[model samples]
Target chain A: MSTRRIHAWPVRLTHWLNAFGMFCMISSGWGIYNASPLFAFHFPTWSTLGGWLGGSIAWHLAVMWLLVINALAYLLYGALSRHFARDLLPLSVSAVRRDLFAALRLKLQHRLGHYNAVQRLSYWLVLALGVLVVLSGLAIWKPVQLHGLASLFGGFDIARYVHFFAMAGIAAFIVLHLTLVLLVPSTLPPMITGGRRETSHE
Target chain B: MSERKKAPPKLEPAQQTQVVNLQRRLLLRSGLSLGALAMLGGCNLQDGDQVDKLLWSMSRWNDRVQAWLFSGQRLAQTYTATQITDPFPFNAFYAEYNVPEIDLDGYRLEVSGLVERKQPWTLQALRQLPQRSDITRLICIEGWSAIGQWGGVPLRTFLERIGADTTAKYVGFKCADRYYSYLDMPTALHPQTLLALDFGQVALPPDYGYPLRVRVPTKLGFKNPKHIVELFVSNQNPGGYWEDQGYNGFSGI
Candidate 1:
């Protein structure tokens, strides 16, 4: 019942690319926020890694396009995929209850060939947060242009802080999510290739 | 595109596993470390101030690598004139009369703490030094950037004038705003950096760090503390005003 069937290539590709994109966005986003001279590396204006503000901005904007496209595709796929009901969600109420408990306890156990209700919930939460970050980012970046949206967050200055602070929250979540993925590697390949082994090591 | 890997085998081979594991460990360790650093950002770095000192060191290390091995990273590109913005007319922080005007004559930049040289220099004396000037954009951490020309002396040149030693690192700027902005000495002395008096060939604006401000090229605007009062060169980390809040202290722009 939980055997690994082949996954859709688009689904897998979008998942991994989006994951990578978010990681880069957070790392480089905060790096620019620091404004210290510590990160002159990784960035285009630096030697090491993602440290320059301008280049980091460019990279963030570019990958942001990728993330937006991938996220939209994933959302559409989830709505139309045959597995949406059977694998992604077993039932509405019971699944929501179990997911809530898992979230509270921080117990993330990835079920083979199926996203436990908790996994589905966390994934959806991250998606929502990503959207919030982008919207807030635009408000701070071009406040006058996005006056309507920026006003929603109290104004330009406040929007800037909100955008930055929300980034901190998102960065924390990303760290937790990555740790989970590494701890349970059984489920990742499906989103990269066509399908992943249910338990290649197990 | 070339950066993409083959999504590694689910349970990677030993060699591959070691590499990925190492990377994961580094990310978690550094990300959480940065997270913790930020969590305590507004608060004085716990009593030890270990993170502050570490950031000071990291500031130097990163500047060196970024400027050298990663030269492309530090290659400051010029934006088109069309990209430049002259900033909205100042409506924020109207000059409050409640604050007393800083007496520039009485002011002497004090250099003290863990240094071989402890001295002070008057505003006139600071202005007399061989100067550096630049026309560049200042990017704010709050997500805005302003392009303006700035002129003044480099803090590194000042440190050299006073005989700073190999042991010293951070350059702490004391300001009339009663705010402190700290920089690793290397960054303070970088070639493009400046301690400026003019914002685009005129007297500095009252709202825009008047009298003097530290113009660290390629840094976020927060590091540009306006209305400078003094400069201190030492081994310890001199932090920025906002850093005490949950923002990144060593914000490498």
Candidate 2:
């Protein structure tokens, strides 16, 4: 068995920072939503991040900057380092399909030093989704000033729903991500310590 | 690097136009759906007290960004009469039943601060000014929106007539309901901003600001101070009731 550097400092930093920021954003967002709820039931106050509507707005606006800056940094670093190409791209369709079936059958291999086709695809998709969430959020937040953006989403109303549903999608992704992480417990340590344990092929 | 490709032959104007439109439509549709789907994943599973401090700090930063983005010349979306929300929802810090009652016979709008005229204008005088009507959306920060037909003097007209120092930083309002708010000078001068007198065609009901309210379509509903009895133009930041309580002062959407 051998250990190797897997996650970079920037990757781990952004991953955890985003996790923290999104936590505040989603909880407070629920509080703000409760004021004029679209769904039948409201998020329980204790579970929600912000204490009240006004407080929630404050929290959302504040943490939004953190998420934006962190995401931007992650993207810029990934691009400059060619991390996307080396780690997440060149995904073969056949391999992806095989991995999908294997994962579904609970027969997928847990590689310590590498990502499977499904993992790479999900990570890339989530990255893309994060950017969309921010843009749609901006469209809803400043529809008049960002009229062109709002119109692109059909209208301001559609933009709001897009933002809402996008958040929900991200929430769903988190659930699957957590389950996968637990199934492969070693993945969590590398994210925190930027090191991985693996058996030498030779 | 790969060699650059040669340019394609130009198409006829009609054909070119059709191709461009098709591309635009495709791009718009894909962009919308992709944007909607991509933002659909992620979760935060931890609870901590320090999160509040971080959020509040970020919220203040967002306020600055929103303030920078606001342009007085731009207009909020206006809808047709048929599109107006039937019975626009009444929202406030207090219950709908607790709407303040004012003595119409004694109502006076007091003007103060950096203005040539500081006279208190009567409701009758305000009505005589050139009036305009608009059906504009009122977007609440709480995530709902409604359109209402509002009729009154344009805030710009009223401010100019009152000889308000247009260069002043802020236009502050003190309302009859004890609620108070203020607007940036540029927003105050927005062509569509109204010192609204009526809800539909009739005088505004007490629940809807009664004798007078500032109907700022460019701002969130709370920034539209209701039952305004006092107006002041000043350079100092006149913090609003909700603003003081942590809501953004320039709560534009």
Candidate 3:
């Protein structure tokens, strides 16, 4: 077994920053949602981020810049390093199917040098959804000025739904991600320390 | 392992072109629209201790963008009287109980700046202006919205009557409750923007800006300053209460 750097410092930093920002945003977003609730049920105030509508908006807007900047930095790093192409790309359908089955059977393998197909796919999907969430958020935030963007999503109301659903999707992904991390405890340390000890399969 | 050995499927030329076109359109739209703001400073995000300044500058840039997008002719969507929220929520920086109670007998709206007439018009005189009414939604920055029927003189007409320099860059308001805000000249002259004296077909209530409030349906609720006691047209930027605190001045949505 050898200890090697599995995640870069930038990656780790951005990941935690994004996690904190998203947590603040989603919880505060719920508080905002409570003000003019679209759903019948209300999110418990204790579980929400801000104490009131004004507070929620303040938190949401502040965290928004955090999320945007960190996400963009992560993206730029990934692109400049060719990380996405070398590691996450070429997501063949067959690999996805096999990886999904392995995941379901609790037989998924962990590798040091690269992500498994399921990890790659999920990461990519989450990234894409994150971009969508940001776009839809902008549309809702400036509906009239960003009228074209709003119209692309159908309309302002539709953009709101898109933003809501996208956030929900990201929240769901976080649940699954955390569960996977817990199940494979060894996976968690590398994200924090940026290195992992792995045994050579050969 | 055997399944992974197979090559990925290929898309037909038509399908490939469609995908490329879609991507291009999305890129172009965001680039052209958001580029104005994103390109303003071009400052590195990692600039330590300068992030707040950058963000504030971006907010101001966004204000300019929204102002540019605003058109005086485009009216805020109107609703029927039945659509009005029964209890249009009372919202302010302070609690509802703290809503200022002005002395009606001495109430006067002092007009100033870039205008030929700097006369202080009393509430009675303001009421004499041709009263127009509309049922429009007031959107708050807090993601809530409510429809209300508001009646008052059109701000454009009043601005014109007062000889306000319509060419001025900004229309600023000072409220008796220590609240102040301003709008871009275009939004100030918007057909739907009103010096609202009545709410729900009655004299404006205290909780809502009593005596006078600027009802700008095109902008977020915060941009619509209530309990307005003074107005001025200016070429210089008159910072708003929230706007100074990082909220966008041109908060149109």
Candidate 4:
């Protein structure tokens, strides 16, 4: 078969936007969490983070809405269009496993494959954690709606701590994620532009 | 001259212009971003009072709009007991002072102004009335929250005991630390509200406002002033310290 371009446009947008939004959230969230100051901003009652607290809250809430909307659209479109399996779910377990280890090796030869199955696995795992972040956030923010959700995580204070740690873990993942992208931009373009200039086959 | 050979010419006008234009664009874009960042970095106000009032009023307005739009639904959410830890780990600075040495027991909760009962009642007397308990939050405005069970008489019951004058419009609380603040009578005596004495099935801890404190669930932590030594009825807004220092007087949930 002739070499062809396979552009999964919806997945592409979700990939890039999720990255951008999460990056914004983590930076702003750090400011909000420490309150006194962690970076760029000073502490003391007089010193509020430049935009970390207020700005992070706005960004976090806004991006959170966007993330939810985009994820919902992706899910619904997948279900309606019968594309979730085709576009997102993996094809073969053996191939996925092999690719996962290959990605893990980070060999110079395989770097151009963009994301290996390992990357996909990590991405999916982080997405699941994102759900936890949202749930815990809501529990702490409005336990009344979910009714008793706050009590689930050992009450409001613990829930707040969980929310913060979840955000931090996701943030750490993003840092690792960006390092991968910087090391492997050939793999990055497919996410931004929906297709990559594939030079070789794995 | 013959050996020197020809060197490559400098550039085509388009190429040279493109290079210069890219530099200018890069410089301008970076400059704009820097300026914007600097602006956001500034305090954006001459004094904290200005910022505090502006933010507080804005918060109050947003709260009102949210409440109006959502109807009677609370802007804050209440939690259920599924994962709720019993005794909801009490973490606070005031815990140290909540010792038995000064339990505020026999503590007279004074009821004065526009009322039939113009005397002080001990904690024992206040507890004699019908008691109310509920699991609710201690939501600090600075951004920490807690959910603990509070036990006390409904503030309305206390008002009833006092035979509050129909003209009385506000209720002021004087605390052990000399903190003085008051609330509109309507808010002070709301049905779910209480002047609490027991926390987590034990006598109220000192720092947690042991002996007796106020629990108006529908407001920020500061509004639920702890360690109240006296309950004075009034028509005037007996401003609390924080309120006088730029916090909201209403301090609703």
> What is the lDDT of every predicted structure here?
0.60, 0.80, 0.79, 0.61
Clashes of each: 23, 9, 0, 9
Report the CAPRI category for model 3: incorrect
Q: Which model, 3 or 4, shows the larger lDDT?
A: 3
Q: Lowest lDDT 10-mer window, candidate 2 chain B? A: B32-41
Candidate 1 lDDT, A1-202, residue by residue in tens: 2365657666677767876677657766755565433224333322211333433443455456667778788777878875555556554668779777886787755566666666676666666777788888766553433446867888655666677667667777778777877977755665556665466534
| Per-residue lDDT value at A197 in model 2 | 46
The TM-scores, one per candidate, come to: 0.46, 0.85, 0.69, 0.56
Model 4, span B1-253: residue lDDT tens: 1222445359998897566554433332333233234433464533433333334454456444333433123434444544344545443324544533454545677777778878888877887999988877666644566677778998888888889864576888888765567766666666667889887778887656767888877666777777787888777767775554434456454
Ranking by lDDT: 2, 3, 4, 1
In model 3, the clashing pairs are: none
Per-residue lDDT tens digits of candidate 3, residues B1-253? 1333556459898897566454433332332223222322354433322433444555656666666777778666677888899888999989988999899899999999999999999989999998889998787876667889989999999999999899889999999998889988888888888999999968999998999999988899999899999999999998777765545667788
DockQ of each: 0.03, 0.24, 0.10, 0.06
Model 1's chain B TM-score? 0.64
Tens digit per residue, CA lDDT, model 4, A9-82:
77667766666556545554554566523235433422222232443343344455567677777667667865
Q: Candidate 2 lDDT, tens digit per residue, B69-88? A: 98878888888989989888
Candidate 1: tens digits of C-alpha lDDT, residues B24-91: 33432343344334344567654323533444344445445433432212423344545456762332
Residue A66 deviation, candidate 3, in Å? 5.6
DockQ (0 to 1) for model 1: 0.03
Q: By TM-score, how accurate is candidate 4?
A: 0.56
